[model samples]
Target: MAVQSWTDMLKASKKTALIHDGKRKIHYLFKDGKEMAEEYDLETDELIVRKWRQKSTLGGQGQWQVEVGEQLASPVASSGSDVIKENCSNPVLTRKDTKTSFQWRIRNLPYPKDVFGVLVEASERCIVIKTSNKKYYKKFSIPDLDRSQLPLDCSAVSFTHANNTLIVSYKKPKEILTLEQELLQELKKLKGTAEGDIDCKTQ
Candidate 1:
């Protein structure tokens, strides 16, 4: 899928059938090295959650992990109507969005900065974090970029360790920023159903 728009992006899936549990529209995509599942609110068609997993170096499939749909609200906070907020109260991880980049903070790492490494796996189009001692490992995607159909750039990824926390940041691409503005403008014209009008919908 070229992902020309938000609808195009949502429609690019390999699953044969679309499924919904009355509250959300669910879709699945399975590719060479990764698989993803997405959920969207039925009334608003807004992404509710996404989970994905990738092939492991050890030759077995890795466990499915969240790719930022539920925990992180829409990243397109271009309109005054949308202001992305972080749950700093989360004990494990918290995300902070800045003007130029997206950042994720993982707490209680207790390791030196050198022990942690953050990298972008282009094949999976996601970020992977690993420790030298093999104690901590995580794989997660940037939903903002994914929704915008943007490519992952290894150079944009960087990390630092301080105060027993590991903070990773990815520089935002210019294309994504522009697309967000356009999407926000387009979304303003559409009226969504109210909370009481929810219904089941297909992907």
Candidate 2:
């Protein structure tokens, strides 16, 4: 009997999945930063297995959008073997039942090569971009939270650039407190005036 290596053993035990009009033999083993898998095709020499990160909602329970390169693959299935991949980073994670909003400026930035990263709030989903330009502002309606938790009732947001860093401020009190405890401490550090109440800088 011939001696079999671990690689050979994994290749022999990989799970099979149909994709891109061909059957792919996927081994649930990790090697060389790539999952163990083999693609058998009659037309091409061999299919290359590429691994990349994907974004998901509900703590990765949601659907995944695979990132390929400059181009993204659609999730829609066409042929039996074709796999649809999407290109974009997943949104930041937050606690459930909490609404949050982010504000940023697109001015002077390069045209977005990937629009999947831009999320729409009202839609509570990601959208595709047709064109790229400066002065482009967008708002996203994220899941796991209500609109009331957002700042200014989901009104206009602002971003301040200072010392090569962007500072985002929210008009809501609870929202600001949720971001940092030090901020709340700073707010508490303010002193009251004798005549009336006055806002003071804690930091």
Candidate 3:
């Protein structure tokens, strides 16, 4: 049967039923003419669904649904858009890179103080800036990087000037490697450097 027809059948059925599509089996539960939950075996199917019963003690009956491909096409479609509109209308603040090496800048500083330190490295959605005495790291996005990069794992970021490399001590080595690979890829695109010319070192 069609997906929508299946959804309608589940919504109308007050009693729970099991649906077998040959490849997988799905348990559908309904309560008061509304779909309540759907359980799927992971070994057969990759998708699972769940429904939360709103208790009066926790909160009154909340508006919830169990459906596939039903997404909020607009902000106002799901809920009021007052907050979303206000946030969207606000001007995006970004760091201005004077050297023209990268499109990076400091954001959210007080007025009349737009000066920022040099950009050391730009990583996945974050950038590292070297201050007079220390290195400040901030998120990679231009609008979110107001002051400095947020310290990960409390260890400050270190940069090697010899090869223009950034060193960050991460608890998980795999995450560090992934970030390094992304940075290398970005550098290649920006500098036109070949893969063989880029060297990444991990300690």
Candidate 4:
């Protein structure tokens, strides 16, 4: 889907349903034999979990597969694969999450450390990265804070430049950590069955 018609798809989906679970809401729908489940924070209504599954080619029931669930530690990207686009290649942006911190890296930025500025826009609830040379600019927000209903903390945000990459990091809040742990447990309890269409809820 191109996203322009996502609303129409949502409207057209079969067996569309919503379930209230703790501080989160799970939405389920079926279309073309594929099922999608989304979990949103009831307070912010921000999506925290998304996953999809369909019929298994082998047998009876297909297991639920995650698309964008809780992020985990990722292997470092190879420098060869990071060279992406433009005559002057820009750093490929990547987000890496760990138990204690949320990190973002912009690769291929060859600028000096003094020329770059990383600022947390508290009112806007986003972090802005820009360069004095006007070569690059990026603005991103932390969905974990929004989903946990925690105020964005500028003091927790920091950055460093090394190996032609600008690394931005934010220490994870204790509340956010606890929320994730609880959410993971809750998610494990959700069961889905595809008889004719899909319906998912706590078993």
Candidate 5:
């Protein structure tokens, strides 16, 4: 005869169906829908087994009965209305409105008693200025600017030295293209010239 342990009997009692002979009750333990063991339960008949039932509340909440030995366990208490304070919530990122302004100025140079020997190279796209000392010459280029950005009238742009500073003055124009747009247009022209040169070499 095979002997079953107390732990085995208790585990089997969880899903066991009770078979009553009117004299003694038999609880059959099943694993995977196959009977594994049988245990005699004298108190299973005396103890109350609550049938599982579903209940609903006025708040539209549903509660289910737990299958305990004696009585049904109480439903968990609901936490009253969710109150979320804005300050306590996660921070939201916001993009601030910003204005970007650009200005260009030429500062004075050192050493020269006066601004002389200055050579100006002007083109439709830009102006190149070269100044020379006894030993070396320094070259600077000022790009063509939009007419709208000028100081108005803008008959002529002038560069001079005054108060130990190089000053540039121009008449502002009413409308002008952005510096970036002009640069891109220049780059496209350069690219086209480069491609033409390559095609000539390949030919």
Candidate 6:
């Protein structure tokens, strides 16, 4: 992406959920070094990106009001035969879960004219993204782990649009068991069996 200091606050909470205990979350967009927070509600599929305008009054502190902006949609979707062709950069992978079994999918990416690169960052809960160039940017939320059938975790996330196909893989866990731990288990098993079989000839 052609953004200057538009780093994503992946693990950080950019905007508070405005729904008041509703199933809404925060997505972020940074333009020209300024951060804009977008609130998305999963229940209603409604999105609102807001910009705060400061209004100063005489002999008083300035008041900040929420100014609603354009509705930006997530760039991920299913690929079809009629999809248009475009060039998208390779997906940046981040591992969410440490399990052995993997879950993944191929999606059709929507590339806006200003969208230069698709930045993907995955956590244990969801995958956050931002598609942007120099002048503009858009934020997306692709939940990696969801109980509902509508959205689920993708161990291997891939996207296809015309000639470009982006695939994202999960980082494997370092190791489940150490060599020393394995050897100790084997020794314990052997000792347990050796004690029980020593008097077998007496019978």
Q: Which stretches of candidate 2 lie over 4 Å from their true place?
A: 1-81, 87-109, 112-139, 142-156, 159-172, 175-203
Give TM per candidate: 0.50, 0.22, 0.20, 0.52, 0.23, 0.20
Stretches of candidate 6 off by over 4 Å are 1-103, 110-124, 133-164, 175-203
Tens-digit per-residue lDDT, 115-186, candidate 4: 999988999998999999999999988865764456888899889999999989899888777665665455
TM-score of 6: 0.20
Error of 4 at 32 (Å): 18
Per-residue C-alpha lDDT of model 6 across residues 1-203, encoded as one tens digit per residue: 74221112222323323333442333232232234444434354333333443325454434333333332334646677666545444332222221332223223443542344433444434443445544323344432122111233354443323323233333322232232234223322322222224344631
All models: lDDT?
A: 0.67, 0.33, 0.33, 0.68, 0.33, 0.34
Q: Which residue pairs show collisions in model 5? A: 147-173, 148-173, 150-171, 150-172, 150-173, 151-171, 151-172, 152-171, 152-172
Candidate 4: which stretches are off by over 4 Å? 1-88, 187-203
For model 3, residues 124-190, the per-residue Cα lDDT tens digits are: 5444444443333343433212212333322223222211222222232343334434433432233
Q: Model 5: per-residue lDDT, tens digit, 1-203? A: 75563334334533423334421222233332322222223333222222232224454424433221222324446545564334423222111111121122333444353533443344333333334555323443322232222332323445555444444444323233343244323322332221223343531
lDDT of 2 by residue, 62-119 (tens): 3322221112344475655555544333222221111232333222333334321332
Better of 4 and 6 by TM-score: 4
Q: Which candidate number maximizes TM-score?
A: 4
Model 1 TM-score, 2 decimals: 0.50
- Candidate 3's C-alpha runs over 4 A off are 1-15, 18-36, 39-43, 58-60, 65-203
Which regions of candidate 5 fall more than 4 Å away from where they truly are?
1-104, 111-124, 132-155, 177-203
Judged by whole-model lDDT over C-alpha atoms, candidate 6 comes out at 0.34
lDDT of model number 2? 0.33
